[model samples]
Target: MIKQTQKINFGKRSGLEVYPVSMGAMRFPEMDKAIPLIRQAIDAGMVYIDTSRGYGDSEIKLGKALKDGYREKVILSTKCSPWVFKAEDTDDSSADCTYKRILESMRRLDVEYLDFYQVWNINSPENYEKATCKGGMVDGIRRAVDEGLVGHIGFTTHDEPENISRYIDEADWCEVILLTYNIFNQKYKDVVAKAHEKGIGTIIMNPACGGMLAENSPVIADAVKSAVGISDAVEAGHRYLKSDPNVDTIICGITKPEDIESTIANFKKPAFDAAQISAIEKAMNKLSPDNAKVCTSCKYCMPCPAGIDIPAMMDVVFHDKVLKVPGIAKEKYDWLTGENNKNASKKPSECTACKECEAKCTQNIPIAAEMAYLARREEQSWK
Candidate 1:
């Protein structure tokens, strides 16, 4: 229960009183199992919900949970997939698909109107062009707004900092932007500030940096616990995000009823003082290897042809080389490569030096080379 009364006047350009901690309805279970978690979030004062059409059953599950009067309690935000527009043969076709998707989302959510509708995954310059082109999704969104189906138009992106800043600068019609922001990658801080300067509300996604901050990295966990005087690493991560004055709200995917409770409790915890934050940052930089490229573990470089767990393997480098915790690194590396972890069928050693993963990396990391490094280290280390 966040007691500090931290709320955001989201969409100052467009009008919703949103909470500082929004619920991301991405990882919920089936309807019967998900309702309690949704109810718990509502009870905890999280008044905003963010979902996506691409997130499998997220919208439908949210629709089911928001039934029985829960609908009136929260503002809804969902995305229209870019693929919907890309598949269109003509701009008018794209517009039609956009309108249809909005209606479909409304039908699935069982909602009369949505508070926010986002253009999902605008990562490239071409995406921005398609979004803003005449008779395209943007036009459709405007029409949806005119007809009272959507209250505001927004977007979510995984683009680099410069492009993101450019998008914010150019998108005056967009009232809100959802983006990746966390401890490891604060390069977008200036852009987030710029959005605030332009009166556009910002929502932080991946505040845990794809669960890197949530992992049981001994040095990180200890430093965070000491910084906040708390034992929970997840709570510490949430608190770190909440500490940023520029961040209006943090959207986190809650998988359980207890997750909602923990999220709320964590948000209520006081932000770290300046000195504490400095100390924590210092510890992170000191422990992290200067030689290794920072991998935020966005998992964009996935579905490795050789079936390597590229993201998890990258974390192994951070733990073993940077953090200098070979024991923890070895444990995770072994688990991910072994049959114990159901999803990880292939080891880092199986990397075929295929440059496919590198091509998709947003950070332009030499992912194949990093995989090779991990393989070499694994061979040498028996301790």
Candidate 2:
């Protein structure tokens, strides 16, 4: 059992306190499995629970899990997706549409009120405009708060750091901010600090870089071990994020009981002092020239119109070049292209330079060019 620890103030503006580590319900298993996992997390002191309407059936399952008095122990949050409105009709961006979405989310989650409600997926300038435009999603959430349906309103983003800074500057209604930050990507580090200075609660998503940092990388593990005596890459990555005082909390996607156990155990470890944290950061800096080339495998550039597994292809390249393990890279490439893997729908050779994947990439990688290079390398028998 995890012991209760002193809670930290989420932010001066947000007016909430919570554990330093929280759980994101994006990867929860089926209903039966999810219920116990949710209960276990809350009992173990991870009391901030975040979910989204965009996550398929997640709200429904969470509603079931939070029953039997489990709801009272945690901070509950959910996001409203404006793109869902646009898909139905452009007129649906109105406040009425957002209010209705909030109601639906409440009904699904079986919750009377939410601690935090966000305008979800503000990924581009256009999306930011749509969400904040006259009588838009933000207005709708404000309406809910007015009527006691929400505690605080905020936004989640995948936009570039400059755009995110702009959003924070303009969003007077925002009381909290959720965005991606991890060991492999620190581009948002400045943005997070900026939000902290403004007294907005900062919750970091993708602290593990969507499982990329969790994979066995002796190079990364050794560097972290040398600096802090922590060899597990996943734990090291979590510790790195926790070392940032500007960050209020980090939301990790937990799928199983063991995941929760490991997460809690990792958080329970003593935090790195300033010098140790700096040493680890310097070591990682020496490993990669720029974060843009490092893929977090967030899969934002996914569902390729041409059916390419772009993350898998990028992972192969990452292992080859960054991790300096050609053998592991070749094995991954084989598995990605192997016929036995039912999900291997398309290989890098099938890439047509559509550029759609490039547009949605959070890292701004030249994905088309990388695809072409991978295809050529395959032709040369991976020489």
Best by lDDT: 2
Each model's total of backbone clashes: 0, 0
Per-residue lDDT of candidate 2, residues 250-319 (tens digit): 8978898787788767877777788987887777776663453577788999899888888888888877
Query: Which 10 successive residues of model 1 have the least lDDT summed?
Result: 84-93
Best by TM-score: 2
Model 1, range 5-91, lDDT digits (tens) per residue?
Answer: 656677467566677787988888877888877877886777788988767788888888888999988888888765533323442
User: What is the alpha-carbon lDDT of model 1 when measured against the actual structure?
Assistant: 0.77
lDDT scores of the candidates, listed in order: 0.77, 0.83
Once fitted onto the true fold, the runs of candidate 2 whose alpha carbons sit more than 4 angstroms away are: 84-91, 289-316, 319-321, 324-347, 351-383
TM-score each candidate. Answer: 0.78, 0.80
